[model samples]
Target chain A: MDTAFCPTCQVIQPTTGNVDYFRLFSLQFSFSLAVEQLEENYQSLQRQFHPDRFASRSATERRLSLEHVTRINQAYQTIRDPLLRSEYLLERLGYRVADPGQSEPQDPAFLMEVMEQREALEAVDLSAAGAAQQLGRMREETERCLEQDEAQLARLFASCLPAEAGREAVCAPELRQQIVRVNHRLRYHRRFLEALDQAEENISEQGV
Target chain B: MAYNERVLDHYENPRNVGSLDKNDPQVGTGMVGAPACGDVMKLQIRVDDQGVISEAKFKTFGCGSAIASSSLVTEWLKGKSLDEALLIKNQQVAEELALPPVKIHCSVLAEDAIKTAVADYRQKQKSMG
Candidate 1:
């Protein structure tokens, strides 16, 4: 039902492969990004590659726009979040939390901490009124831990990534270890936050 | 969102939801978590002299699928010998629950919990002997 896009998006730029998400969105290839600017760029790219602009074109051109639009959305999601972006960068630099695939996370100490938190959450009194009091305090604890993980992420990223060029050059073993630790820590906090949300839902479902 | 009837029944009235004494020599405790979802399950089994599971208990902090999975396992564990219990597999539990593909992990966790609890019991037996 359409055709005639402007010259700006005549072709998808990274057709060859290994498209760095940060660079795809006109941002430096680093852990930190101006999230607002990233969102702005995402919208602009989506507009540029809007499928409606390609319907009247050849079949291949139409299909490419569809594919490119999906890629743009994926890149936008990866680049916009601090946690996901850190994991992405760490993987790009060859840091793997599970080396042989599907193995449990190797850090026993961290999992022990996760276990304790879960235990504490489950032990809370489920009585409606008490649940609120317990969950509120639990929320503060989880939020505080989440914030600390985020601060660690920021610190690691700030140290590992320069303001300009050559992300590969910065992947020293020490930095890789730091990134992996931060990534694991970040996952723990993210998962805890998710659990806290589920707990709150269950409590409120009981009208607590 | 159409859960299997068996799964719903189990979730609504989870069987054997509690703790067993960790200090008891006959009680083997298995605690596990899935980092992907932050689901934690603690399953305990009391083994008699013949290695038959005398009683089973569990406390799970997770979704309905996980709760159903653990409850189903505890029910299966009672009266089964430790050797017989080893034959249990995640696929069987998944099929029994008619769990959707995404919730198959719950079944896997259930299977893992069984093996872990039994292993803990055996280890204690060996230590005391």
Candidate 2:
């Protein structure tokens, strides 16, 4: 029974989605990261489990390699973007963000502000140079919003993580509430970026 | 997944595609957003003194399924008594629309909109009294 095959060794590493991404990447579990080091580690891991390296290994070993590679890719994706990283951190802290069941409330005044921005974005003349400027402006505003949220997220996580590094992050009710609000607003930032990208693509396709 | 003809038909020719004056005493407004997909829906109904819904309107910024769901509910709400409206479940909307599993959230949103609208109306009536 060849039941003890691991991609790295005889030890089976935890799966990416289920485990802490920092642990998955063999990095310290903090919001701040040395991106170059992350990239280097990712490349090294990918090279080690590149499937070709496991072609002559046992079938179980090959399967394990594939699983590791899938997890590695997923972890990389989750950690690559600040918004996604913040979401992942919040998730690890046991909040589902905007889960339908939990349905957290957002500030109505803030929502009205976002809606007005959307209306302005909708009215942009994509055929004109002003379109690019308009999109850029909105994108900047969204990025600013994201940056502010990320700062808040980092502060919240920093406060919680140091006290309980060995166990699940001990989330205060205030932290939970803040995380939910930030996560909800993060959707708007993401939507703005997506909309901007689509508009830009259509404009480029039309050569306008 | 490819939308079936009925879903597409509803999407293309949506019913009650407008807004109600939310400030109006007779009107009840339910505005909901699905944080999962970032879809927002606004559903409104005008209830008569006898508690019958006489008019319904909806405006939704979402996928075709969500739009169709809101549209279908508006049509259903027009002739429904408040009690009947309260009883209309999301499953009924899903069944009527032939919504696939992935689109079930849209139906849920529709049902929620109805309940919220009723709740809003009741609150307004209470405050008035």
Query: Which residue pairs clash in candidate 1?
Result: none
Q: Number of clashing pairs, model 1?
A: 0
Judge candidate 1 at residue A54 and give its lDDT.
79
Candidate 1 stretches with Cα past 4 Å from truth are: A1-18, A34-40, A43-70, A90-101, A106-116, A123-133, A152-185, A198-208, B126-129
lDDT score, candidate 1, position B64: 93
Candidate 1 lDDT, A1-208, residue by residue in tens: 0122335764433243667777677777776567877888888888888889877877877787887788878888877777778777777766644332244533545655776787888777776467877888878887888678777777777776676764463666887776676677777777777877888888778873
Give per-residue lDDT, candidate 1, residue B129. Answer: 94
Per residue, candidate 1 scores C-alpha lDDT tens digits across B21-122 of 877999997776665555678889999888789999988877899999999999999999999998999999999999998888888888888887888888
lDDT for residue B103 in candidate 2, whole number 0-100: 85
- Model 2 clash pairs? none
What clash count goes with each model? Answer: 0, 0
Name the candidate that leads on DockQ.
Answer: 2
Each candidate's interface RMSD (Å, one decimal) is 4.4, 2.8
